[model samples]
Target: MPLEFAPANADALPLHVIEQAGLDGWTESQPKSVVTWVRANNFTGSIGQVLLIPGADGAPVAALVGYGKPETRARKRFVLAAAAEKLPEGAWHVASGLPRDVAETEALGWLMTGYAFDRYKSQTPAKAGLVAPEGVDRTRVETLAAAEALIRDLVNTPAQDMGPDALQAAAEALAAEFGASCTAVVGDDLLTHNFPMIHAVGRAAVRAPRLIELRWGEAGPKLTLVGKGVCFDTGGLDIKPASGMLLMKKDMGGAANVLGLARMIMALGLRVQLRVLIPAVENAVAGNAFRPGDILTSRKGLTVEINNTDAEGRLVLADALALADEEAPDMVISMATLTGAARVAVGPDLAPFYTDDEGAAQALAEAAAGAADPVWRMPFHAPYEDLIEPGIADLDNAPGGGMAGSITAALFLRRFVAARYMHFDIFSWQQANAPGRSKGGFGQGPRALLAALPRILNL
Candidate 1:
């Protein structure tokens, strides 16, 4: 996209951003022909309003995007980006009018607008592009955009090509790029190595199940990330209806998102000894698939009664979280597309997280807002602990009566480890297309997590 931008020269179109209050003064400085054009169009600089000033030859000489009202800008993060998509086909540079504090975020938003998933179908790339905005970190913005592309690409791929083996390859590729170490416990080796629940839940699929681990960095506080890698959930023996299967390809979104953060961390050289654990699997149904009423033992030695096979995501995540907690890392954070209850709680836009650490929670909330990545802190409410405990086994995979589903799921994962743990119940699919974010596998929480890490870990 940077390459697509018209070279920063006299030939490039200058893009001026205007607010309603400055409209008259801005017009006063323009040529009479341009002023008349602006007045005739009644361009008041409201959001999403675009206009082009033409020269005597009639080709566009300049372009402008409205910044809208102060209150309108306050309610949205990437308001200018939405208007960016509507600009005329040509290269442009931000000439003036972006506040210095927002310059970087808006520039990053422009880079985000460059994404297009062209794997299965050829896409006509956007002709319009922007050079790096003034006073912005070019390296940081590109790194973030590239990492985000990784998450979207991995999640966008179909389960046929993105199963456990492929997921392991992706992680190993990332590790190789950073000169880190990566290893996976695959198929029957999982049971031989004590990841019983992970093996059991994924055993029915023809594609083998595996536990992938990547290690990097040597000098700093330990940061461990555990992600649920359910590539495609057919809901095992409990079986979801056809409607429930449409976006199942994004079930592995959590793993993709964690890897996105890892990419940002390594690329930015954050001071942390990072360990990423992914339990990659396919929750498919076969005669031998793990079923309801089956009691399985987790890596942490907790027994879990499966009341619903559809709850297999937390089962795999449980084993991975247990493994992550073993070394007592400074922090353990797990991300997963875990439950529909989470979607009901906050809809599809906000990532809902659970943690008992107040200081860390506060830091993350503040950081998320600044990063333009919204995340809400849900409690690790102790009162809901009993809801996950089944009389028969030590825990219930799916508690009946389904109240506080997200909280109960978080509590169930909490039972596996004792650490400064935070869990994000994410809905990683973007249901509608918007500027900078197309309607497919989208990342949540990771950008916010990236922003908050320095403060949360005291780097």
Candidate 2:
């Protein structure tokens, strides 16, 4: 079932969040039996500690969750969710002890804890529901979770079911729901439409490649989003080892996240003309697959030497970014699970983005902290621009020597983008399950961008 809020006025019991130092005083207000129960259970209010107090009737009358010390809380996100997961299946509300500034965030964390991707098996989540805390918008918080579920569902699907055609169908479905326009340029038509790089990277796969486009909201500042949609990367002619191919199904995580962001924007009726471009493909190995030495011309007329076929995500994105720049929208952003170097640099938890606009960067940084969606800004670094410039062609798909690889990949995509652009190198997969997050397809940057759009676009 979807994550939802319990009715504002339901038969919900009080849930108290306590700190270690204040535990004694908190218990003083409770009945003697409840205090005895809490003390006997050694409930010191460490972070995520769970303790339920029973009434004279021997039924749970209230619950307690430890908020822990300031330092413990500071080191983690979704602190409330840690304890929320341990609660029994029922409606819950934070009655007291949570700080005001964190009320909304904690409420959201509660909802996130309810997510479970059970599309294939019987992995149903506990039917735990949270009442929206005071001053938090339940509708907005729930909508965001639904949109996030869309990304998780799409990314969690195997490449066999989520090929280019399926991805395009997903986009069309979203466009239909919003009364927007959705279209695609597929297969040989990609060549006809001048998306040669996208075609070249995906032509080897049995499933045709496509540039999926969805447009919405005609009356506001134009913002275009480009996402890399490589459905399954076998690394083409330069195939990856078997171990590297295990998670290849998540290569389209960027497109999944973009569609998720699009859902957020359209659902809220945000005042902005939103255009989404996703270059959908599968970097599968085949007899006629584009080779390592092959040179492909992009829609922008820049030639890229394929030094490594594993670098195909950037190729497809280059064409899409060039197309996005043609309109010179107020802003253009590209999201891609583009490089392993990104994970090596900041690990899988952080979304690393690059942009030249200080205002937009600052706005995003501020919004990320508030949203609990962290993003780190990487520099364009003009001094290293030469790293992408291979002598054989205007650019090299993968520069030799892996030093600063994420930066080089960013610079390569930067060549095709001339608008006020930002690129997010997202992992888009949860490395491990913790708190509100699960161990499967996950989102990294959409929330931060969603929160920052208003300030960045003056919407």
Candidate 3:
């Protein structure tokens, strides 16, 4: 977004910073030397000890912000953003001493603070975008923020309008824009096309569930992206409480994320054969809905016992993953608003991903760090594999144990993937309101994944 308040960078900046500890009385002749020094340098003063400074023209210059000590965790950069909200609308840089990591995060926080979801509201008051101190690509930073914003809008929309058909339509629209091939196996065609699990999970909905496939890039390394597109999960036959159903619309956030990633990939013209698969469905409760205790056959030819209908996300993902696996693509990645356990484990800010490949994992971590959209690596512990066992089926969609709910969910999806796969169990919602991320639906992992792709396919 274009900044309402534009602040330009110059050759040199007059900085004002608060002195901490013993440095307070460096120039002791005057009581307000800190303020005087700040003014002399064309900067501002701090509050730990407030003092005013006169500039070259004998006028008040820039202001100084103080952090008594270093921010322990990187996330505390938001405190600086809160400070930015108060600073006068001008090109202002943090004239204080902070670590390189703190500086980067604070800059990101400033960008985030400039975010306002004014799709339905009036324009917000102008706020200037921050200027990175020495070395930072402002465009790359904004791309990550914009990707998250796009995913949030898609996930926050109601399922009535964001249903399977609409989801497929959205993918088609994106494919059309990028000159990609868009196709779908809709309704009964899912069975005809061997996507039994996907069809079974979505059969109850009146709008009909579908497997939307989009293929882009004709000559490059084949990369497949699959997402759990449960538009609104009602927990199938197992049924969820009223509270659990409240945020079900965001269940399809995985699809939203992948689609958002695709937009970035195509927009940047990344050199990779991008194939996006979204198994769009609404896990609604009805007479025809798939039931717990039922055995469903996945596209990979594995029979899965439905221990809990509430665990339907992985079931649909099973088929989609199986389809992606068939191509044995160079790389395959998937995202899903798959489990509450993930939320309980990591809260909402950091997304947890599981991958068996070390090289991919390292690349993803580096990209996440560079992009400022970090993801934590959760082990796909082999010992926990037994939790997903089924007595009468090849596997159990819902594991018998709840200890490693997120891990088991990833493991279940793993069963269908025969190639290099990275699975994300994302919370996909912001618990509280903050700058760009509203108090509702938010995209968690797309930006990181998008950033990592260039390395993944060696683009």
Candidate 4:
């Protein structure tokens, strides 16, 4: 369901404040009192604890929530989200001493707590909900958060239920609802259709790989989005360790994100011809899997050596991107859960993108700042292009040295892209749990891109 953030009602929830520890004597005393009260009652905050005490009137007032071990916490980034998770169904105000910005960010984060992937499961009474905080752009926050939730849900599902055929089904369903046109080229037909690199990568998987395309809008500037949709990466013939292969289901996070972005764009009626391309594949192992040292041609007609079948994402993307590049749209952006190197560079929360367009970079920077969705821009270094050089072919899928792996990956992809483009290397899973972030699959980077779109496209 689309997320809805209603404007915070002022009259209904009149007085509230958010307070940090060590702020003042009352603030310091309140936390101690709350803790003491919890101990005396033999209640634990581990399962989440909340207590309501008498206020100025005879009626009960705002409650105190115990968020365990503030010192060990990494910034209490989503503590307010806990409130949404556990609070009873009702409207409430922030009544302590949180800074306006922090309070607002947390307010939006709280709404995320309501998400549940019950597609295959039955609903429980513990289902959560919340009203948007007062004086905030409820519509915008709901739109963005709901879009992100959609991305996370799609990525979290196991590959058996989310294979290339299923991915195409999803695209068709989404397109039908949004009045967009959807088309796909599947299986061996990929070769007949000139998506050679994509075909080579997924020929091994039982589920036929496909290039799912959706186009929406007209009478406006063009924006093309490409997503790496490796439904499950078994590292191809060069298999990964069991640990490395554990979460391969999330390999298609980029595909999920662009679909989520498509949802938002169509819902908002953005002023652009939005084209989404997703090359969905399962990088499984088999004799037919393209082997290392094999030369494969790309949609752009560039031959690449399979230096490592593990580098299959860029290969499939190369074909899809070459197709998108054919139009030289005003903006071409691609998202991928592509590299571990990116995680080392910027961690999971901050996605790293490469682009030579200064205006686009600055616009994204400013948009992220305003939206509180942060991102960092890496470079499309021409000098590093040599790293992708192959001894036997025009380019190598995986370079021997790990130095600048993410940047080199971007550079490799750059070889196939003819127009100005940006590539996002996202670590699409959350390592540790937080209020709104659960323990398993999660969305990354797309929210920042959504926030940046209006500014980048001058909407």
Best by lDDT: 2
Q: How does each model score on TM-score?
A: 0.96, 0.98, 0.83, 0.87
- Which stretches of candidate 2 lie above 4 Å from their native place? none
Which residue pairs show collisions in model 4?
Answer: 16-94, 16-95, 17-94, 17-95, 17-96, 18-96, 18-97, 18-98, 19-97
Error of 1 at 172 (Å): 1.6
Q: Which lDDT tens digits does candidate 1 get at residues 1-459?
A: 431233455356888889888788788888888888998998999887889888889988888789888988887667667767887666688887888788767766766776788889976544577777778777787788888889999999999999999999999999999988999999999999999999999999999999999999999999999999999999998999999999999999999999999999999999999999999999989987998999999999889999999999999999998888889999999999999999999999999999989989999999988777899988888988888888999999999996899999999999887989899999988888776788899789988999898988999
lDDT of 4 at 349: 81
CA lDDT for candidate 3: 0.76
TM-score of 3: 0.83
Candidate 1: deviation at residue 31, Å? 2.3
**Candidate 3 segments exceeding 4 Å error:** 1-68, 73-80, 88-106, 119-126, 131-134
Flag regions of model 1 displaced more than 4 Å. Answer: 1-11
The residue-level lDDT of candidate 2 at 150 comes to 90
Candidate 3 lDDT, 30-100, residue by residue in tens: 34755467446542223233333446686546555544344333443244555455555556554555455
Which window of ten consecutive residues has the lowest lDDT sum in model 3?
Answer: 43-52
Q: Write the per-residue lDDT of candidate 2 for residues 30-138, one digit (tens) a residue.
A: 7787787887898999998999877778888889999999998888888999988888888888888999787767777778787887767778565667888888888
Task: State residue 447's C-alpha deviation in candidate 3, in Å.
Answer: 3.3
